[model samples]
Target: MRLVFGLVLIAGVALAGGAVYMARDYIAQYQDQLARERQATKDALANVKSVPTVGVIVTNRAMKYGEPLVKDDVRIVNWPEDAIPEGSFVDMAILFPEDANGERFVLRAVEKDEALMKVKVTKPGQAAGLVSQIEKGMRAFAISVDVSSGVSGFLRPGDSVDVYWTGSVSREFEGGGGEITRLIQTNIELIAVDQIAGSDVTGATIARTVTVAATPEQIAALAQAQNTGQLSLALVGVQDDTVATAVEVDQRKLLNLKESAPAPAPVAEKVCTVNTRRGGEIVKTQIPCTN
Candidate 1:
């Protein structure tokens, strides 16, 4: 009985030693796994920090206060996919002179009521009004003429007219030959028949005066024509084939030239003394003969 009890005690000691050995192995394996996980986490963090950051480059010399932020003007710090929120105030460091550090620019939130952008730049010496002020082409003055004047009656705004001038003039040449007659001004534009005509004139029998858009020089020329010659408006109908021409005539001077023409010269009569002779006898006689 004593021998059996000693063998049982020995077996129990061996079992406890094997159990301790297995537990130590398990503990070591768990510690190695934990070390690997820590190394992996450090490697991931280092890779994230090593990634390059993107930035924007501005080409415009001046920027508005709240202009829409472009991607090239901004640089992502740690977060690459995030976008800068609208209404953010951007500093000058982000706008002017290239090569500024990313840390110099700070974005602050702007209120909803604030303006998003500004237009502060324009041509030199010109005042900036609205976007409408910058017209595309040269502008000219437009004259309005009543459509009721002869051709004006049928004229509509935008119809091209051949302006004619009519007047009277008398002229005396070095030899004193002159006459006068009436002159006419024709073929002037019927620009705006009414103030409310569309950009391009349209419609038939426009109720308002036809208006003509012309340069300042053209206006002066038209005024001169009107003053010198009784200006008459001629409508260029859709089918009118007559080409425009300018004519000046002086009625009184023309009439006077016709009346002042010199009369024809009178012929002179000659009286002749002739000698008369008979058939058989010669006789001398003096007689007055008219030829």
Candidate 2:
């Protein structure tokens, strides 16, 4: 019995030693693989050429029209050197020049990560108000409107509309007057609502007056039309670029009057006159003439 117990103990010790050796070998193999992978990554990185870059000022968050451009609203990011945008600001001094009196406003709405350009912002000390938004050779004209005529207050700045005149026309002769509704202006750009020029307004606005940018000729026509009749505005889609030719509708046309066909032009009856053979005295008599 003593011999058998000693033999079993020797076998168990040998088996345990073999298992330990195998575990150590497996761990060392994994460690060597990790070291080799790290070396390969270093070699790959060393061969890549670094791209040249420059600091560019970009909007940190979205900005709406009429909002002032502040230091906190923008930040500098490293942009590729070759693709730097025009009018980009590289430093704080250039962005907010000391002579500007710290008054820089956003001319248009800017989105996140958008680079700031001089054209996108207003001039130094110039407010992003309605006056600044007017286009060259255009005047801002205000017209009265309500919820019914104002597109249910869905109108905002930068939206285009079609103006219509609806009223009866005064005529000098009886039955010459008629009530008509016609499109006076098409694709007119709205520049303001009440006094607000920014479309970032919180609630729906049924502006009592809408200011539109128009040429002098348009302004003159609109002034006369507004006084002659009630002006109604039709909202136009942003993508609607085509101006309708002549959209005029009277009460008769709107009701689709299938009036009688125009009466045929009247034909005059042919009459032949025969001269009497009295010397100096001449008398004429009508006789039936055949075609």
Candidate 3:
């Protein structure tokens, strides 16, 4: 009987030892998993802190040109700090001041969620017009255009154009004489076409006059060119960065006619003069002479 009892007790002790070992193994695995999860969370937080951001004001809905920019029209969004655009309004106070004398107006069409930039909006209490659109140190000059000269009214504000002058040039000009077309200005920005100054113009507008933003020097050049000859606008492609060279085309060049060399002037016969004293006056006689 004593031997049977000892065997039962030893088996009971072995079972308890195995149970404890299993529980310890399970607990160790759980602790290791918890540590890994904690480390992963820390790594994720560190990555998030590496990037900087800024709050930029963007339009909540599509805004049109000349539309009033009220407080409800814009909202702040997190924008990448390094990628923030120039002239962007990041402060709400500056964009919409309480003591503002007048409301601000949109100068250009802005799409939904587009950043509200200083160049696209007018100052507080300012009206949206050619004056507001003109940049600092730039003057607004009007150029007269027709169907032939205006690119058929396909131009819109904010569009870049190359100005061509068509008129007669003196013989001293490099393009010979007669009426010729020459590219006088390249990449000139148009601010208004006729009475429409918005970039969201839908259809082709046959404009009579187009206003352009230019420096004083550019305005002077354009005024002189417009007065001296007919000014034509050639629409420049948005993606085109190539500058138009000294492009001049004459009637002869258009027809692929080579310039005929000017005829040499006939040499006058050499004259020999003889002076003779007669009374009180000197008389001169001309005689044919050799070369």
Candidate 4:
């Protein structure tokens, strides 16, 4: 009996140890499975965030193509909550409205290849299109006479003015005669203000100055007018079609005189003769005329 009891006690102890070992193994296996599941969940979340979406606003307009998409401008719609921004630096493809014809539109940002908004191309105080008739080498005349200010130094280079000068105008008449009239150098371009405080007439203060340009003949007339009667500079608008047409007519007349008058007669060449004396007998010999 004593032997049987001892054996039974040993068997019971072995079964308890085996049960403890099994429980430990099962717990370890469960913990490992739980850790793997947590890792998989994290990976899934990262993948979901990486998926691209539509209508995402990109703020950086300077971004080029083929770059990684990043979050910028706000996302609009049709995008997953975890989706990454698409086209962080994409060239926007715009579908302009038909009524917006002739108007320029610049894309500041884009999402899913769609334009977000129009950007301002010009800056403040910047003049667009062609300059307001104020260009280099252009001629202008002073409108007001500011002799005290050296011919109105208050004026500017870009400023437009009306030049008033009086001079005796001499022109060829129809019958080989000439006629003189009071010539006035009206609207003229002011290229430079010589003898003035500064080259630019935009704003200055001087007196008794002279101006120069490509065509100073008109200014010379104005100077003559100043000597005779009164030379005045009138600030006015730019030259229009009418004034340009008159200038063109004057230029055409100066260029083509045949259109204005009849052609002159061709002059005839004179002949000469040489007299030769042969033994007191006079002989006349004709010489060929050369032009």
Candidate 2 — worst ten consecutive residues by lDDT sum? Answer: 168-177
Residue 46 C-alpha lDDT in model 2: 100
The Cα local distance difference test for each model comes to 0.46, 0.89, 0.92, 0.45
Count of backbone clashes, every candidate in sequence: 40, 0, 0, 18
**Given candidate 3, what's the lDDT at residue 39?**
100
Residue-wise C-alpha lDDT for candidate 1, range 140-253, written one tens digit per residue: 334334444446456653466665545444334443223322233234444345543332233455343345555456667766755654445666676677765545445444
Residue-by-residue lDDT tens digits, candidate 2, 1-291: 999999999999999999999999999999999999999999999999999999999999999887888889999999999999988888878888888865899977889999998877887788887888887999999999999999999898888999999988778766446898888999999989898887677778778999999999999999999998899999999777776889878777889976689999999977899999788898999988876
TM-scores for the candidates: 0.32, 0.70, 0.70, 0.25
Model 3 spans > 4 angstroms off: 1-50, 171-176, 259-291
lDDT digits (tens) for residues 154-272 of candidate 3: 99999999998888989896746788988888899999999899898999878899999988998898999988998989999999999779998888889999868999999996779
Residue 232 accuracy (lDDT) in model 4: 54
Compute the lDDT for candidate 4: 0.45
lDDT of 3 at 95: 99
lDDT score of model 2? Answer: 0.89
By lDDT, the candidates rank as 3, 2, 1, 4
Number of the top-ranking candidate, with lDDT as the measure: 3
| Count of clashing pairs, candidate 1 | 40
